[model samples]
Target: MTKIGKALGVLAAAVVLPLTLSGTAYADIPFNQPINGNATYYDNSGFGACGTWVNAATEMLVAVPASYWTTPNPNNDPLCRGVSVQVSYNGRTITVPVKDKCPSCGSGHIDLSLPAFSQLADPRLGNIPLTWKFVRS
Candidate 1:
């Protein structure tokens, strides 16, 4: 199964309720971040590169590949860990934190926690186009 499929299975085992986003996106947050990508979520949470344990209930946790920390990246050692990120999709936005790495994900793909995913788009959508950028932690 694909990584997203596996994650979705994990999500199915955890919760199926969809979260509602409040209000519309604020244009002044300056999410002018250059990075944009697609997003997916998993059910059974696992350990992140940072050595922290996260689960489906963990709010605002995300994963980026190793490249996010290497050259051409500017966030520091743990990549975007602990950084508040603005994820926008379908005119809605939510802020989540970097929790792990997506070894199988491509350059612009993000694996988000179920809770965080719900905040951006409907869980039923499975996958969605998203744009994100680093914000003050």
Candidate 2:
């Protein structure tokens, strides 16, 4: 091939290579896996809102959205009912209830109540790292 043709081929390959590589990298991520995890409540008063409790040892507070509370009646979904949460702080585990909605929670953040905070430990720690799962029972 001519030098010009080879340069064009190289440029095209550069563009196409990234597209192909990124496609495979995206597939490596398990999108099907549930986006479940521990989140901290951003309640200034330290008293978090109401939600569902899940898991056994981990204290994860799944904050319910405002839309769910606005309705005259809400369904008893486990996610909405507050599932048990497992909080891991300094390698210690504490369980707390999922209560209330977090006004500051950005999208996936879960808020917890003061009572729940106490159950896990102290809220002063700020942004407690927790791991949790959704349960049917």
Candidate 3:
């Protein structure tokens, strides 16, 4: 091939090769839509996985499942920004901010702060079945 033809082929391959090797990205969790899952309470002291300091007894906060934590840098995650979830259990419902990650939790599960858990059910209950959905904070 001529010099110009060789350069063009290399350029095309450089672009197309990466595109062919790239994997598709898709969301595993459905935001806004209601999700049924089990919720457990945790003490929110020190810095959370989202890199924010919170008080479990005072602030209504929740930790999303690691499977749903899309970003490597939790501080830059949009879910930890101004996003919150409305959790319903028994006859109670409460909205809480997304402030951390629950590495052991399943994709559909959530870890609520003590106060947030109390708002939905008795914190002493440890775990409770609930339905929740994302909401603007």
- Best-performing candidate as measured by TM-score: 3
Two-way lDDT contest, 1 vs 2, winner: 1
Encode model 2's per-residue lDDT on 1-137: one tens digit a residue: 99999999999999998677555543443322343444554433333333223332244344534432432223322233434444444556555444455445553345665445555657777566554432322
lDDT tens per residue, model 3, 3-91: 99999999999998655433211233356899999999988587887787887767789988887665567776667657788998888
Better candidate number, 1 or 2, judged by TM-score: 1
Candidates 2 and 3, the one with greater TM-score: 3
Of the candidates numbered 1 and 3, which has the greater TM-score value? 3
Candidate 3 runs further than 4 Å off:
1-29
Candidate 1 wrong stretches, greater than 4 Å: 1-32, 71-76
- Flag regions of model 2 displaced more than 4 Å: 1-38, 42-78, 97-99
Give the C-alpha lDDT of model 1. Answer: 0.67
Evaluate all candidate structures by whole-model CA lDDT and list the values in order: 0.67, 0.47, 0.80
What's the C-alpha lDDT at position 127 in model 1?
85
Residue 76 of model 2, lDDT score: 26
**Cα error, candidate 3, residue 49 (Å):** 2.0
Higher-scoring candidate on lDDT, 2 or 3: 3
